[model samples]
Target: MSDAGKLRIDKWLWFARVVKTRSAAAALCEDGSVRLNGSRVDQAHKAVRIGDVVTVALTGRIKVLKVVSLAERRGPFSEAQHLYEDLSPEPPRFEPPSPVAEREAGSGRPTKSERRDLDRLRRPDD
Candidate 1:
């Protein structure tokens, strides 16, 4: 059993130092990047309970955790570390960067027009 209290998943993540900030946690949740008890939870204020399994899909990695305690306030690392138990295995190790894609024949920094095209490509089409 954990201390009795309700806390937001995002708040808990930030307070527990699982993420650098509450905003980051919220974004993760919104993007279906976070799961609680095996289901994706998209609300920043979704209540969290002790023993609940939390899964965070981060850049190229997944972090699994078991809720151990709750805290509303962001605190020192020592205090934050007490709030959760990491169930995730170490992230896979990788050697020096391998080329993920073949370079174009004349690849160079994007020109202004190319930058605009890049921005257009990045825009979410509705």
Candidate 2:
């Protein structure tokens, strides 16, 4: 790529395979979930440079990554992984799974009429 050709932040994130799609990256940018140099960036068109720190807030967790290289196009996993380095010192700890609700005993699968009744309950009066 030429010196003038630089990867956009959102495009880089997508090319890096950080998020599933380009739209997701744009959404993250619009939502202020993605930041550059400790400040939120509004436009996804911003150019990304090597060594720039990127913070991504995703699904109730935050991930920090450092841009290591620029990619103009989406590539294979090996190539994508080289684009950035995860700098989070620690992994997000797992929370214990919630307890399942106890079901009443002898509550066997409903019959055809019972199924209809359940479906009726789901519908609003009209």
Candidate 3:
């Protein structure tokens, strides 16, 4: 559907909705967080076409996608998803850190010296 078979990596990413905006896509590329066909791509203008693979290091996640088609405009999620094949592996599950136990109310707050001791326990570097 695209007139041009070739597309800039940033533009493609934005059009596909992989990123929120063209500038955000450019920043992701400029920061050296994007890889094209296994090679690191630091420039947003790097050209991409069908069958190319892109690796994006998003915050707290990594996406591996294969280009399926080129999009001319930013579109809805359903439409944008047609542009690429998602090959990123499922993200590993993370368990939340355990919450610190709290002293019962009316037990009274710890004294200043006791508070310092608790702080030391929490921060070993102190």
Highest TM-score among the candidates is held by which one?
3
The segments of candidate 2 whose C-alpha lies over 4 angstroms from its true place after superposition are 1-5, 95-126
Per-residue lDDT for 119 in model 2?
Answer: 67
lDDT tens digits by residue: candidate 1, 30-104:
998999999999788898998899999889888899998887678899988888899998977888876544347
Give all candidates' CA lDDT scores.
0.84, 0.82, 0.91
lDDT of 2 by residue, 9-44 (tens): 999889888899999999889888899978898888
Q: After superposition, how far is residue 103 of candidate 3 from its true place, in Å?
A: 3.0
> Candidate 2: lDDT over CA atoms?
0.82
Q: Order of candidates by TM-score, top first?
A: 3, 1, 2
Error of 1 at 40 (Å): 0.5
lDDT against true structure, model 1 = 0.84
lDDT of 3 by residue, 45-70 (tens): 99998999999999999999999999
Q: Which pairs clash in the backbone of model 2?
A: none
RMSD of 1: 7.2
